[model samples]
Target: MIYELNKSHFYKVSHLLTGDLVNIEIKGVVQGYQPGWVFVEHIDHPKTAMIWSKAIDGFYFIGDENNTDFNDYINQFISLDIAPRAKDLGLISFEFSGTSLSWDKTLESVFQNRELHRSKQFTYKYKNIINASIAEIELQNGFEMMEVNVFLLEKKLSNLDFVTSMILDWWDSLDDFFVSGVGFCILYKDQIVSCCISSCVTDDAMGSHTVTLNDYRNHGLAKKLIHQFLTYCRDHGFEPNWDCMEENLGSRLLAESCGYTKDSEYILYHFKLY
Candidate 1:
């Protein structure tokens, strides 16, 4: 049987569960989570048993094999083209591989539109890139580049002009991006032209999310802003980790330019309801 946990002990319960910290988005929620649901089996002694759990906009399971009734949970979580809960919940997606065959297979069958994606993950430790910085570009003569605190700006959080994708929407759902996130941008005429920032984070890793105005591409603004962001990470004791679809060559090249090297590939399983 599964049951919801009291909000008071989320931190305690999270510490008790041993699992992957790679998905920094999920890590932040688990570590100092908000009022999201945390359903677990074996309520009486959850830590003593292999557990199955999911938080809002989070991975379905960790620390154990997936439960048998995941389909029922997905059904309760969403319906055909409509969500009865969590407005602004643009999309909920999960990725896994050989280790989570059961949950992977289950979601593939439950969701209607399934897409198999691949991302070449990369990492850059502070030591390897302390001297790395962005070179000036001729087109950037009138632009200003700087970092901004996402947690403090409600306007930016709700800004529709920049929130073009579901991932950006997910960043907005975060109660506070500063909890485990960072951001930087290039402002041209007070509008974001190019930017690079962490959309999700853990204690030691910041998940990379970067963007540039389509019209401003090839100006090298992303590399400039991201290199500075990496310098900030070096000073703060965090490493920037990245993952993008295998076919996104431009993204791959930008990562390489900023001192990141290919590390591994992940099978990202996306299930979207249209």
Candidate 2:
């Protein structure tokens, strides 16, 4: 029988997570600051497990290979528990760690009748900002820099809805964000055009994310915002980590330019429930 692992037993599944963002979400869940679920085949001595982060729609699998019963249970859980809730979310993403990678085919079998897509994700760690001049870079005539805060969220700027949701959805509330996150943005004509923030935070490290309006893409605003982000990291004694799709040249280039070295790579599997 399947069991929903208690928060106190979360450590049993944690041994399988290696990604910074995954770790951050799991930590937040453990601290009651994030929403997630943990399932195991055996409550007291689980040999198979799955950790799901609600905010990110991510699943991390850890288990023995070819465990038909557990895999069957996962398939049922996806169809019943996950599909209804995740229909609004574009894709459900999955990762495997520890000995679970060997179960790739076993896991994929569960989604055999569905459309499955796979992509490589790279994780980066801070080396040193290559462009020391980033901080001194001046914006062109019409652009300005601003700090992101609750006041900005209160303003409800139509242009910033995406950024606002990115913060609130991940942190769940403004109070949690104020306690665990930091952010900055670039404004063009009083509208936010680009932003950088701690997408995930743990005690000693932060996962960085950047978003620039399509129209503002080539203007270097992302780099400037990242410089501010790195500044905050240095001041607060946090190590910065970046994760991006292997196919995203822009994100990969920005990380390389900013002295982030590729630390690891993993695969992300995506599939729709219905």
- Give the best candidate by lDDT: 2
> Which digits, one per residue and each the tens of the lDDT, describe model 2 over residues 1-274?
5788887677775555543334455555544556677888877777677767777767766656466657778777877776666666655434433223555666567767767788787879885533233345678889988888877776646677867777866777767777788998888875888988777786777777788889889888888888888878877777788878899997899898886789877667776566
Residue 217 shift from truth in candidate 1, angstroms: 1.1
- lDDT tens digits, residue span 17-97, model 1: 444323444454555522244555556445312121122253434434445543345444444312333334544444333
Estimate the TM-score for candidate 2. 0.78
Error of 1 at 102 (Å): 7.8
Show the colliding residue pairs in model 1. Answer: none
| Candidate 1 segments exceeding 4 Å error | 6-8, 12-21, 33-37, 47-58, 66-139, 150-168, 172-175, 178-180, 270-274
lDDT for each candidate structure: 0.52, 0.71
Candidate 2: lDDT over CA atoms? Answer: 0.71
**Positional deviation of residue 18's Cα in model 1 after best superposition, in angstroms:** 5.0
Superposition TM-score, candidate 1 onto the true structure = 0.65
Model 2 residue 41 lDDT score: 80
Kindly give the stretch of ten consecutive residues in candidate 2 with the minimal lDDT sum: 92-101
